[model samples]
Target: MPERVSRQLVYLVYGGKVEYHQEAKYSILSALHHAQGACPRILLYTDEPAQFIGWPVDVITLDDQILRAWTGPATYLHRRKAAAIRDALQYAEQSIFIDTDTFFLASPVKLFERLAKAPWLVDEIEGVWKEYEGDELHTVLAPYLAEQHGIDQRMLLINSGVLGFQGDASQLMDETLNLIDIMHPMVPKIHIIEQFAVSVAARHLGRPAESRGVIKHYFSGKNYWRHMVAAFFLRHGESFSAQAIEAVREVPTDKPRPVWWHRLNFRLRSVFLSSRMRSHAKLAYYATVLCADPYAKACGQGYAQELRRKAIPEGESLSIQPWSRVLTRQQKQRLAKLLGESATGHIP
Candidate 1:
């Protein structure tokens, strides 16, 4: 018989909010089934391991004592995400720490293969940390980065939701941890410090992370996407482990197919709201826009509406296209029913 080859990829997941828990289940289910020729192990680090009792993942129960020892008394909650990646270094040669709010559209074998050919892989390659006048981090951390590393800032910004590495990227993880240690004293909470840290280390590694849209982030559009998942669970909402998994395979993620009307609408919206406000104003404006969709926004689920702020007159990219029509009457009605709204669509 031909010798069997060892698997080349490992799917690493972590975290423990109710939303985090549900999405983690969705992420693992999607990843394992879609992996083409490899059946990689899925390692989950969570405080509530029992919640995933029967799921096909190796659960490492992360209790308080272990966390304190690992991170050394830091109260920053998100620091654990980076720490998880650092710890995952021991288990596999190739590992990806995926965010809970993501789902795989296809096998990650190609992605792992790509990582083998590069220093690191990030979900989306972006310019958020560059020398742009609007980049907030440039003003805050650039001096420290310049003084220490002889670089103004990490050039290749990335959406760190899906962080993949082929070898011991401990230097990268240490950089991330160091960034958090330095910045935690200044900021109320160190949000997204890991991305910047990884960018710094990736720069040291001397390559840009490849942009592979293999996994779709329902992150911005999750309010609507959450409704679809809830609908799928139907009566199975009670137990995530025993819930039917196949229907989650059908959540509609197709970007609004471009149409002439959509282009015109995009143009009109651009002309009307086109002035590029400073980043603060843009964030404030997006927060207000989110209010237009009340149900999911309040619970902190939807934020995709902000895409309209970046829309333009001539761009064909769906990334800048607002949902145009978020929901038809029928779709809203279904969501209403899911939320236990009445026939008249009134919430009590």
Candidate 2:
């Protein structure tokens, strides 16, 4: 008999309001399901345990203080996610850290395999450093990074949304955390926190030796929004986005499965629909669906009460593109009904 090959484990770290619990659960589940043959174990780390449903997978909870120590409010819940990755180093031989907002279009196991063949794998967002006027943020954070953390200015600009690392590489994790610690105090921009940490580490640590490692940064264009939509459908099902429901309904089941990026575009359409502020009725319905449970409760009844205040008068047709035109007839119907219900004040 042939010996079974060991499977690589993947970890997803997230911390945020419980209202997004369903979204987070669905995102991980979709990745697990889609990458069934690729990853062996999938672990989730969070700050609030109550937000998650029971699962056979491993779950680790941490205190807010530990989270704050690594990342401040600038990144909000994402700060805790970074801290979770640091904690995950004690276990597993290799792991991939994914943000909850990300959805898998296909098995990313090959990406890891590719990374294993290379040195490192990280993602780079479009126009990251270009936004920084001069290197003020980079320069100010550089000294603290070098003097205290030993990272250079050039390396302080990578995104941490998706990171692949060898489980045995504890040194990399330590260097990453140290950089996070040094940069956190000097930089207040929460969005750049994770990227800044990774960039610095990569630059300071030097590309891992061919035997040590290589780093490949993945870049995606505006099309990435489509992945978010696909993730929303897999999680919220028919509840969250009417457009996603329509898109899924229209897909030919026999056709080769849609790529992750295409599904992402479907989801992006929903976001665009929800943003049509002119459709007060549609806006209220989407808000009710998107708000999740406690989030709505927390905002009280007034959260969406104003939706009807500026509702488009009955019988007045809005100029927005209809879901049916964008998707199949069946999908269009489902979405139209949901939108109609929302406009009619039946959602709450």
Candidate 3:
């Protein structure tokens, strides 16, 4: 028999939506495919384990009861993310918690090495939330966080997507739970609670956790990547053959280089967007182009045909999967405008 994995694991949680579960599948595939050093055991906590059939991962069935307890009195669902860190404590002494949208661009072993220096590793998305403290929309966890934890430095507000715990996570988890139980009731925005909790717990434990971009956090490009990934998996299924990995590697991490015509057209039409809008407009534009990328389009089309052959019920479509929608011209324009409005500084 093959040797069993007893220590050092990777944990991920995917529940509720099929699209999210599907996304998790690709994320895990990317991790396993690119991992270097001693590949740790992968543990997926979800109600659906069969989704990852042949993929070399251990599935921990997460029933509704567990979710309810994880949510507890908190009405919002984000609490479950922090609760998940608590869950990891029971299984592995050292673990890397990966979010569905994240991919291991390099060996995650380096992450464990960093974790050895500290108890936690945080994802640096927007630098520190402290930078956005003046903006109420961005600083959702501040005042309440201050009330609960006595106003610690708000320098490292991180995305909860990539978390690494080197030692016993019980203490951090307990403090995090206490922080959530109090703050969730005090402040209504539970979305940032998980990442905020991780930041707070990390602060309480040790020094600042720096981010060197070990994992490619596709936080903004997920919508496009989803379509690209779905097509890859639809063609390959659970198998991680070398060709499949190589094919996925083609799914661009950055925006496709724009042709001179596209850039020239943007310059001429730059009047409508502000400085911030220009940056977001560019991102939105690129994301739109990538959403309908030729490879993804072909894969998506093939998957749809495959589904149609199986006979989807009336009123229901074979293309019911998430991230399946092609970006309409008008819709893409509106998203660019919206992103621009949300943007604070110049993007150049």
Candidate 4:
């Protein structure tokens, strides 16, 4: 049979952070491997070019204008994501934006297929009321809804973390950027930057958005708290109560699976085995050695370990250690020279 035509392209926005980047690469590779022929190409938008060398996907750099305006750590991430979407609009048939922190547990082609029936934004939680339970949450959104959007106080807030846009849709890019520009002054509350703006724009445009299958906000909820406690036990071992791990482990994975928890557990396992233990060795040694790689063959990439081995060269210095050990005085001087500043003036 002929290969299925790829109707959607996915992009992940990332900074140069080691852990997130490694996970991002793994996410993309895993997505591609599992969704083979289901997704055409996966693009990574990053400031660091060295990170994408051996990956099967394409890597694009953020333009200087976007980089300079990258006011907050991951706040810049959304801007880069919007820019990449606009860029991809020129070539792709359809597109979706996923955060670097996300992992694809199943083929997301159904998401793209849904867009053909209607142009919509993916809903995170059920509705606005569910998103805001009380005054505390309402206060955070008052400024955007009352002042900028002129909407009733009861509107639902949508998350922009995982979004799909139809390529043929008109002004989608323009409207998205305009919303971002409007939210620029609200930098202190940058955590809600993209979501608030996107929610407002969808309301204003009267555009309908859909939720991807069984989505869960991993960072929230009692179940997540339990999993976090379990991860802590896995990383901290006997230092953390074994009861917590057993409690979480016994919580019955047989229940309906949560979308985001699978990814979160995958990440916790990766860091627990890799670097989290190295930093707090005493707390983690027993646990790290005891736990199996939860994500070992979970990613669907038969060659995840092999790909990592090739991408990260043998003996390549890591940035996690102290500055002195990673770089020599002359090397620091050379870096300063390239940055066009004195070595002493630069902050480590």
Top-TM-score candidate index: 3
lDDT of 3 by residue, 167-252 (tens): 67787888888777766665574467667666777675555354456677777755556666666667776564556655657665
Per residue, candidate 2 scores C-alpha lDDT tens digits across 249-308 of 332112122346644545665554544542443333333333233222222123233333
Worst 10 residues of 4 by lDDT: 282-291
Q: Estimate each model's TM-score.
A: 0.68, 0.54, 0.72, 0.55
Tens-digit lDDT track for model 1 on 1-348? 111223333333445556667777767766765774364667778778788777776767778787766553456667777787787776666677777777778786767776778877878877745654445556666777778877754476777888887667777787788777776555545466667667776676656456356788766766655644454444346354523455445544443223456435444544534344333223222322333223323322222223223432332432222332233345334333332343223422
For every model shown, the clashing-pair count is: 0, 16, 0, 5
Give me candidate 1's TM-score against the actual structure.
Answer: 0.68
Q: Cα RMSD to native, each candidate?
A: 9.2, 10.9, 9.8, 15.3
User: In model 2, how large is the Cα lDDT of residue 112?
Assistant: 67
> For model 1, what is the alpha-carbon lDDT of residue 183?
64
lDDT of 4 by residue, 63-146 (tens): 566665643333445565565666666556666666554445446565666666655656462466335645544655566657
Model 3: runs farther than 4 Å from truth? 1-9, 125-148, 208-211, 238-243, 265-348
- Highest lDDT: give the candidate number: 3
